[model samples]
Target: MNSNSLNNKALHVNLREADMQFFRYNCGGWKAAATLSECYQPDRCGPRRFSFVGGGGKTSAIFKMAEELSDLAVLSRPGAEKRKVLIAPTTKMYLPRDGCVLLSPRLCEVREALAVEPYVVIGQRAALPASAFEPKIEGLPSSFLEEAAMHADVVLAEADGARHMPAKAPAEHEPVLFPGTTDVAAVMGLDCLYRPVREVCHRPELVCRLLGVSPEHLLTPEEAARLLMSEKGQRKDVGTGQEFYVLLNKADGPEQLCLAGEVAKNLESMGCRHIAASSLSPAEG
Candidate 1:
């Protein structure tokens, strides 16, 4: 994509509220729209709601999109009124709900510094006391997952990994404790189970297998775009009908990046025209 293309019209979705504001200024001029719930219906447009299950790079990815697409309506949790950007100090301390709350202190510090909310922070979970747990938390309740999905325009769920021992070394691992994955599993019930895979090694076939759907059924970028238009009841752009885009956010590790590339290629082959891939980070350039 060309630098000039960055100014194109798009919809932005993000986990960090502060980043939304940053993008408003950097990406030419754009609109904002928050997904009030987790599951966003690609078929419907106008206004929609979606939920956010905090964790992973998904939140960062969403916020980046929201910033890029500044002209659209931005949707977010009504309760996220304080509008703080949180950065967890350690991996172990990140609890979806509480993490956002605890970072209020760091948020305050950073907001004061930047004259803008801090996009990241470093701290331990206050509830742990000494910073360790015997078995660690197992999983999230199905009810909570469902509730989050209900409010999002498109639920960005992490469907890999489960709560377990952390892996060691050059190989990167996906922590199995994602609430979004658990929610999807529960929603699809016995019908869906995301097979665990090494973070970088995950393949489209594996995802298809977990969903009990065919690899061929995976929609291409163009196909995804067409579906979005049809579902949202949008007319041809007149000039260009593209109203939104999907960001396939991946970890910075090489293996995960490779896997993301394959997925992007597959989506392109299938015609998902509006999808793009990027790494998750909190700096503006």
Candidate 2:
């Protein structure tokens, strides 16, 4: 049976209940795990310079991660000092709503602001007009990101652009990951399943080339799984010794959750060490 049909076989269930199931199945093997955070190693040091690529909810995931890291008294490893987070994009990104947005012509001034603000979004001024939801911000140069890593405790960089699509195949020059990035998160939307590639994926032409399928083809679990594991696709420019993770975002319903399970299983088989199937929306405190 095809993967699309397999995911459809299961009945929908509550999202909270689905969370635990994927945590168990996707989190390698953790004997005692009640909460989502418990599944991974408490001592596991999070990446100092992290980059988020892929197609699904990259912006939301970036902000949500910054909030989660900021809330933690300790940043990952024990005795680690809790410091502010820096959210800058290697590619263009909308200004964050909750955090302070600072655009300084001089990188020195930007670094100074980061020292006082727990959350600061720093980037070049974009050509677009700033709005309530979509504010203007251009991307920073790779040189700036390499140097900026020294100023913040944790840095989150949106390395790819998807034009708000849930999935994407990277272009020849996409996902400009900086050399200092110690970890990478590849996000894909679970909602992309059974949808036409052209509708849900960015760079549909490239996705078609990589998948060897037509743009009109329905995105299946196996196809999505292949793209996730493919070096030219999600794993592009993944530096040596960098911690890599696949985030199956938007698993809000049982069906999408089930699809995430299938995708995670494939990622695991392809040697993905960490996989998370969850909503990227930041939870209310």
Quick one: best lDDT, which candidate? 2
lDDT (Cα) of model 1? 0.28
Cα lDDT tens digits for candidate 1, 1-285: 111111112222224443222101012221222431222222354322222211134334434433322212333334332222222221233233221122323323433422232222222334443234331121233444344333322333322221221111111233222223211110100001122323211243433343344544533333222222332111112113323333334323455444444444544554444433344443210
Model 1: CA > 4 A from native: 1-43, 46-56, 62-93, 96-139, 147-156, 162-199, 202-266, 282-285
Clash statistics: count for each candidate: 66, 0
Error of 1 at 32 (Å): 15
- Candidates' lDDT values, in order? 0.28, 0.68
Mind giving the per-residue lDDT tens digits that candidate 2 earns over 1-285?
111111121211122343333244545432323443332333455447778899857776666555556655534556755566788887777654345666643566556666665556767666774555565576777677667767786788888888778889899997888558888888888878899999999999989999999989999888898887788898988877887877777776677677887787777888888777765452210
- Listed in order, each prediction's TM-score against the native is 0.30, 0.80
Q: In order, what is each prediction's RMSD in angstroms? A: 15.2, 10.3
RMSD of 1: 15.2
Rate residue 233 of model 1 by lDDT: 13
